[model samples]
Target: MTDLKVRKLPWEFDESVPFQWNRENPRFGIMMNAVSFLAPAFERFIVSSTRAAMAQITDPATLEEADAFLRQEAIHGRAHRNHTAALVKQYPGLKQVLVDLDASYDRVLKTEPLEYHLAYIADIEATFTPLFSVMLNHQDKLFDIGDHRVGPLFLWHFVEEIEHRSSAKIVYDAVVPSPWYRLRVIPKVVAHVMGCFSMFCRAVDTHVPAADRGIDACDMIVRPKRLTSLFERSELPGQFEGVPRTEVITMLYRLARAQAPNHSPATEKVPAFASEWFEAYEQGKDVVNWYRPARVAG
Candidate 1:
């Protein structure tokens, strides 16, 4: 059995919340906003795919973990739904973007086999520990300066992802038991995720006003021509100037390692902030307003 806590966080977003929530890095903010667009649909896919695969997961402990994992993912879906609803209220055109994302995942669910879907989820979830570790490690730079509502939402999500780091792999191993197949499907999964992000960025570009968004929604995406130019110049663009070169290189290396068949997320080093957040939550501190004091002296 996995020791995962299904904490229901009270997250509320008001009209005052801005699209450029992270004032220090607008590009990062927009990129993460794209993730917010993707989360609900993607989590829905995860829940459905995992539920379908549960029949093959005969191990009682693994089955219990799967149930807990589904509960956490369901809660995450609800939180992200509230977040995206606020965004849609701000920019009604974003409604179409949500529709498009749902349709894309619906197509995948209808077309892909259960094995492929399980492998896809396993591959993606395997990367989160390392990926979110980097983000949480640098939270002072990336998240602490952002809107409290948005930053804490991502913090809660990422820490819980680390909490159940072994879940998808455990389920996949029980059902499919083919690391080669999981590795073989990585490219397709990466392409689909990037395509969804591309769709989100393009939608934001077309819909969210420039002043509100504060940067080109597509700035972080690696297009063909942009890749060629970067390779030729070996120089970072202005948008990426805020991020240290070493951190980027380290993140890439960790992500690559995460894809290995022998790679185990349990062995990976988690960020200190994750532990701190968990401690704070258990202590009944105000986790939703993470960066701000909950009360001021009179």
Candidate 2:
């Protein structure tokens, strides 16, 4: 069995959690909030896909991993639902955003074959280790400075993502066993995920007031060239403006490498912070309020 622990975080987000949770970097917070919109629906799709794939998985060990992965994802979905529910309570239109997002994934689950769902999950899960490594490695900037209630929710989610990085690919290999097929499906998967993110951003723009979000909610959905132009013009704010070109290049390279046919998440370099976060959790540190000195003190 994989060393995947299904830990419940002490996450309690009530009326006080701001839409701009990351006060230092509202854009980053809003970008991640878009993810909050996506996580519950996408994770449900993951659970459904894994349940269908389980019948065909012959290996007991792989079955165990899939079960653990589903449990972890279910917990993730619940935590994100709590967060999103808080948002929707504040901005009622976000309820429709959730409805629309769920419908989008429901369409996929209904229309796509089990293999396609597996491939879609595998393609997206494959990138998390690398993509989140960049974010976790820069936690001080991206997470630590954010709201104590909100930052650790994402931190916990990302670290667990690193822990289960291999689960989706293992299931996919057991069922489909075709790297070329996985690669072939990447474009569609990317388009689908990006389209969902765009929808979330547009909804944020429509629902949340400008003063509340403190940045263009649609900024994150822009084309790469436009992003680069904004970066060059010094229009980007917070950590985005100071992100090293080399760091961005390295992250892009690692993200591409993650999707390669032979790529093994087992061999990927994990961020040091992931290990530290795990250790902290094991030691009973208050991970839900990770940045607060009193809560984090061991």
Candidate 3:
């Protein structure tokens, strides 16, 4: 992990895993594209969170670690943007959509204050840590998207979510000198989640199907054979290297307990995500089964 120095945003990543946007597979590409718009917004929040709380971060070691955290997020954002561009070549309309989304982030920055922004980051990533676990454990959760490419990208993002679950809070606690931050950030983040969901829903309505562009993360969890249906159609067996959904959620709870103070995920007012995670675990799925590590793949 120490050697995993953070990389900057907008970096190049080759995402040529053979994706197509047909009627049945309508949302895979769109979901990929939709998540793509979040990159710039995500990046700006990280950068601002880091700087906004700079004065509070006293430990040199912690600051250095936070710097690496920022670096990785930057890399993620850049890679996604470039990936979006490559996909744009396939779907020309997305280019304008992507630009508008980036512009929207700028608009958000101007509207919200620093505390509100950091709280939103905490809330979003907090929601992300769990929802991501379901996707990260695609097989166990039984989310059979029936594709090889998107899952890997999503897994990579999920792992990174775990990697930096504590960053925003760390920065906020260090820099922002307000007890209200602890209380305020939660509701503030909840509101942000509402707005963010609306944005995704809007994007989905404009682009893909209801199921494909889900309104809540809970809807995505599958109950065995559900996810595999897609891949079966693609000639790949439904079985894949996914971790246990319960284990994944448990790991997140552990991480949450470690990351969030006072120990209540609900007070954290989590975005509408836990049900999706619980269902994935109810399905007793694990994505590690679908995962082919780079070492083995190579």
Looking at model 1, report the run of 10 residues with the lowest lDDT sum. Answer: 230-239
* Candidate 1 local lDDT, 1-298, one digit each (tens): 6798888888878667887798677866886787788989999998999898897778899999998998899899888888888888889899998889999999999998988998888889988887788788878777877887798899999999999888888888888867889999988998999899999988899989988988777766777668543223223223343456677678778888877888887888888999999999999998888867842421
In model 3, the runs with Cα more than 4 Å from the true position are 1-4, 7-33, 139-145, 207-260, 263-298
- Deviation in Å, model 3, residue 112 alpha carbon: 2.7
Candidate 2, 83-192: lDDT as tens digits = 99898889998899899999999999998899899989988998899888888888877886778888889999999999999999999999996777988988899899
lDDT of 3 by residue, 1-298 (tens): 2323342222343445333322233434444445666676668667766665665667876687567767778777766776666655544544665666666666667887776666666556666665554444453333344444444445455566665666666655565577356555565555554455456545445553345333333233343457444333333222222344455446556544533544433233232333443344347544233343443486
Which candidate has the top score in TM-score?
2
C-alpha local distance difference test of each model: 0.83, 0.87, 0.52
Q: Candidate 1 clash total?
A: 0
lDDT of 2 at 170: 93
Following a full C-alpha superposition, what root-mean-square deviation does model 3 have from the true structure? 9.8
Error in Å for residue 161 of model 2: 0.3
The candidate with the higher lDDT, 2 or 3, is 2
Candidate 2 segments whose C-alpha is farther than 4 A from its true place? 224-233, 238-241, 294-298
Q: What is the lDDT of candidate 2?
A: 0.87
Prediction 3 global C-alpha lDDT: 0.52
Clashes of each: 0, 0, 30
Q: What TM-score do all the candidates reach, one by one?
A: 0.93, 0.95, 0.62
